[model samples]
Target: MSDSRGAAMSDGRTATKGLAFHRLSAPSVLALARGEGGGAAVEELLTAERSRRLLLVRALADSLGEGDPPHPAGTAPMAHRAAWTLLARTQQRAPRVFENILMSPQTGMWLSLALRRLRGATAYEDAPLWVVAGHLSALAAAVGARAGLDFSLTVPVRHGRVPLPTLGCAVFADAAEPWGTAQVDAREGRLRITAGRETVTAGPEWSRSAPGWHAVRRLELEPTGPGKVLLLDELDPYRTFPHPSPPRLLSADEARTWQELLTGAWEILRRDEPQSTEAMRVGLMSLAPTPARERYRPHSVTAGDAFGGVMASRPDDVAQLAATLVHEFQHTKLGGLIHLGPLSEPSAPPGAPEQLFYAPWRDDPRPLGGLLQGIYAFAGVARFWSVHRHAADAAYAPMAHFEFALWRAQVSSTVDLVHRHDRLTALGRRLLGTLRERCEEWMAEPVPPAELALAQEVAADHRARWRAHHLRPPAAAVQDAVEAWRRGDARPPAALAAPPELAPVADTRYLDTAAVLARYRLGAPAADPSDIEGVTAADLLLARGDLSGAREAFVTQLAGKETASDAWAGLGRALAGATEHRDASRLLRHHPERARAVQSALEHATGRGADPVELATWLGLGPGETDLD
Candidate 1:
C-alpha cells in the first residue's frame, strides 16, 4: 500500500490534493448561533457533521491513494462486488466541506445493511464485530471512501460516543477486526475503545460520553416462549439519545401487551406471508417503544437498513402491526436492491418537493421515488390483507378489503406513470412488473359495493385535490378565460400549469383506520389545525349525499384561527354543494385552492345548476353572479 501511494505520488495521480480540513471552534460556532438555545444545538450538529465528514476524508485518502474505484482490496473484507458498484460509476471531484458523498437517495441505508449482513455472515470469531449504525459514522465513511477519503474500517464516533447501531439501523464496521474491545460506561458518561494498540477515552470537551449514549441501564431482551419470542422495553431510542421528549418506560403489564401484539402479528405473517416473516426475522431483531406523539402514524420506523432493530409506539390497532412490518421491510428490501444495482439511473432530475405527487398516505407531496415506495409498500399490505382479511372480524375485514382495493387501483395507476420513465433500469422495470401482477391479483378480490364506493371516493377526492393543487391551466390563460366569461365571450382559454401542492405546515397524516370503518372501528384521533383529514371527512360527507353535514364540517374546520389550505379547498366544494353550485370566489383568490373552488362553483352555477344571483348573494362573492350577459 505504501509503495502504491509512493507510485501514485510520483505519477501525480494521488487523490491527496492535501487540503487541510478546517475545524470550527465550538465557542465560535456557538457565537454564530446568537445564544438562541435551539440554534446552539443546530450549530453543534453542523460542527459534528463537518468534523465527521473530515474524518471520512482522511479515511478515504488512506484507502484509495490514487487508483480509481474498484481499486485493489484492503485490510478488511467487504461485499465489494455490490458495495463497489456505485463507487466505479461515481464521479470523482476534489473533496469539499458541506458536500455529501455522491449517492442516490437512501443509498446510505443500503450500505449500512450490507455491512451488518457482511459482519453477521463472516465466520471470524476472534473479536466481536462492531456494527456501525448512525449515518454520520457509517454512510459518510462508506461514501467518503468511494470519493477517495480513503481510510480503513474503524472510524471516529464523534463526541466520544460509542458507535452503537440504532435500532433497525444500517451499520458498518471495518473488514479487519479491532485488536481490543471498546468498553462503554453510559452511567458514568465514559467511552473506552481500544483498537489495535491504541486506547482512548472521552475528554472533558466531549459531552455526554457518546452521541446518543444516555442510558445507564442496559436494555435486556427477555426471551419469551422460552427464547422463541423476545419482549423488549429498554431499547427505546430516547434512552440511548438525548431526546427532547423521552417516552415513559413501559411497565411489565405494558410489555405483556406489546408481547401479545407482536406474537399475534407474527403468527399472521408467518402464516400468510412466509417470506416477509423470514425477512423480518433476519432484518428486524429488536423493538423499541416510541413516544405517544408518534401514535396514529405508521407506528414504526427503522433508522436505516439495519433491520435487526425497530422503534414504534404501541398501537391501538393490532392488525396495524403486521402491516407496519411489511411496509418497513419493503424499505429494507429496496435498500438491498439498491446496493445490488441502480434502480434509477443518473439522468432525469430527481423530483423536487413541489413537483412530487401527493400520496394518499402522507400529508406532504412525495417525490416520485417516495410515491413508488408508497405504492410498493401498499402492494405488500394489500397482499397481506387479501389473505388475512377473510379471517378477520366484521369491522377489520371491511377495512382490510378497502385497503386491498385502494392500493390495487392506486399502485396500478402509479405504475403506468412510472413504467416508461427513463430513470428506471431493467431491474427496476422487472420489479414494477411483479408489483403490477400482485395488483391485478388483489384488484380481483371481492370488496363490498358500498365499501368499494367509499374507497373510490377517498381516492378520487385526494387525486382531484392533488390535480387542483398541481395540475393547473396557465395563469394568463385562466385570467383570459375568467375575463372572457365576465365579458360573455364563449371561447375558453387554452391551459394553466400549477406547481404541485404539498400539505400545509407539517400536517400529521395519521395512519387512521379506513374512513369507511372508522366509525365502527378506530375513533377520530385529533389532528393539528392544519391536518387534511377534516377535509377528507368533509369529502366523505359529501359523497354520502349529506350536504349540510359536509358544509358544517368544512366550515368548522375552516373556522380555525388560520384557514388551512385543505379546509379552503373543501370549503369551495362544500359551498358549491350547499348553494347547489355557484361562486366560492368570495374570498381567497390569492390562493389556487380557493380560486379553483370559485371557478368550480361558478362553472356549475348556470345550465339548471343553481340560481347564480342567489348563490352570489349567499356566498358573498359579489351582489350577484358575474354578469356574463
Candidate 2:
C-alpha cells in the first residue's frame, strides 16, 4: 500500500472541484421522467449521486469539531483522516475501485445517517461517536482490499460483526460486549481481522468457510448470463434507511428460493422489458431481504440516501419479483434526480400547512412530494404490466391485465392532480407533463372490456373507501341533513353542496377489501366460496360480478347491528353496477361520509339501523323537490 502520509498530501479541493455543480441535460431529464430512459441516463444519475456522496463525506469530516465530544480513543478523527487518505490513494491508483465503494448504497446511507447525527438532526442514542465514525474505516478496508493495496486499520464491530461496506462482513464468535473494535489487515487482496486473541483470515474468494467470515452472497441469472449481479446483503447494518438494523440473514433454503426467483425474474425482464433491464443493470445494485409480508403482496422501500439499494420482502412468485425490481428501481432513479434539484418547494407558503393529497397506493394521506413519488413508481409499474400482460401465461394473464389497467388509471388521475398543484417547480411540471403524455398513450391501449370495468370499479371503490375513512362532511351539512330526515322532507339540504374536510379516522382496517377481493378473484377464480381474510361474502360476490347478490348481502349486513365502513362502500359499488338506485349509488360512491353521518344520526335517534339504500336515496334527492330546503 502507498504511504498514508504521502496519499494525504494531494489537495482534496482539486479532486472534488466541480462535483457540486453537476447537472443533467434536459433531454436526459425528460427521458427519465417518461420512465423510458436507457442506461446512459441512469448512469448520469448514478454519477451525480456519487458526487453527492463524496461531497457529503467531506462535509461530515469537516463538521466533526462542532458536535459531540470526541471519542475517548480519538477514533472518529483518526478514521475520518484515514478514510480520506485511502480514498485519495485509491482514486489515483484505482479510480474504478474508488468509484465503486464511494457510490455503494451503504456508503451513502452511512454518510447520511452520520451527517444527520453530527448536525443534531437526530439524537445519537446507543451509537456513540466512535461507532458512527467506524464506517469510514470500514469503507477504507473495502477500498484497500478491492484495490489490492496492503493496509491495516481498526474498524468497529457491532454485534460481533465487521462490515466492509460493499464486500462482506467478518463475523466473530459471540462476546459479552455488544460493541467492540477489531483490527483489519489487508494484503495482496486477502484480508484478516483480529479481535482480542482470535484472528480470522480470508483469501481472495472471501471464503464463507473461513472461521468467522460471512460473504455477501451474489445472485445472478446464470454463471455467464448478461443479467446484472446483485449482492444479497444480510450482514451490513446500514443496509436499510434511518438507522442500523440488525442483520436478519436468510436461512439456507430461503436463500436458495431467492436465487431461483431472481433467475426467473431476470429472464422475464430481459425478455420483456429491455429498457427497464438496462436501467436496472446500471442503477440497481443490491437487495436486502426483509421478512415476508402478505401473500401475493410484497412490500418494498428505497431510501433517498441509498440510491441503488432495495429493501424488500420475499415475493410470492417470479412475476412479483420482476415487478418489484422494476418498481423499486423507478424510486431509485427518481430519488437520484431529486438529489440533483428540487422538484417541489421545500415548504408551504409561510403560515398555512402543506396540503395533503390522495395517493391511491397508500393507506394514509400524502404530501405533494410523496404523491409525486407514488405517481412515478406506479407509472413504471403500470408500464411493466402493460408489456408483461401479453407475455404472461394464460393463468396469470388476467392478473396482469388487472394490474396494468388499475395502475394506468391511478397514475393518470394522480398525474392530473399533481399537474394542477400550486407548489410544483418548473422541473416538476415538465416531469409530470412527460409522465402525463406517457399515461395518455397507455390509456389508448386496448384492455379487455371486463378487465377495464373491473379496474375502474376497483379504483372507484378505493376512492370511496378513502373518502369514507379520511374525509368528513361539513358539520352544518350533516346537521341539516339529519334535521331534514327527521322532518320527513323529500329534498336534501343546501349545505351538502359544501365539500368535505380532511379529518382522518384512525381505524383503517378492512378499507381495502375491494382490492383484496379483486386479487383473490383474479388469482383464484375457480376457488371455493370460503371466507377470505379481511374480505366479506358481499365483497366476494361484488368482486365475482354478482351485483344483485352482493347488494342483497350488503343490505343484510347494513341492516345488522354492526356494519363496517366497507359495507357502505360495497353497497355503493353494488348500486352502481345495478340498473336501479342511480342517485343512491352516486351519493354513496361520491359522498359516503354524508350517508354515513345521516345513517349514524338516524341509528342513534331510533336505536336501530335504517335501510341503507333507502337512506342513500333520501340523502341523494335533488334540492327543492318538496321545498324541504
Specify the highest-TM-score model's number.
2
Top lDDT hit: 2
* Cα lDDT listed for each candidate: 0.44, 0.79
Q: Candidate 2 has which clashing residue pairs, if any?
A: none
Over 4 Å off, model 1: 1-249, 293-296, 349-355, 468-472, 488-545, 552-563, 568-594, 597-629
Residue runs of model 2 more than 4 Å from their true location after superposition: 1-20, 67-77, 123-126, 207-209, 222-224, 506-510, 526-533, 544-563, 576-580, 601-609, 622-629
Tens-digit lDDT track for model 2 on 141-236? Answer: 888888898888878888788888777777778545787778888888789898877787876886364667777888876566755788888878
> How do the residues 1-629 of candidate 1 rate in per-residue lDDT, one tens digit apiece?
01111111021233456533233344432321211112232333333333333343334433433322221134222322223332333323433311333221122233433243333544212222222222233333334333433332333232222332221111114315323223222123333344434444432223222332332222322234323333253422222211212224466677667777777777777677765665555444455565444334445665423323455677756677887777665654454334334455654454533345557766456766677667666667766777777877875677777666676677777876676666677656766766666566667777888668667755654554454454444545555545545665433333322332344434433223234333232233243322334436765575456767876776665544443444544454455533444444232222334245335434544322123223223333332224311
Go through the candidates in order and give the C-alpha RMSD of each one to the true structure.
16.5, 5.0
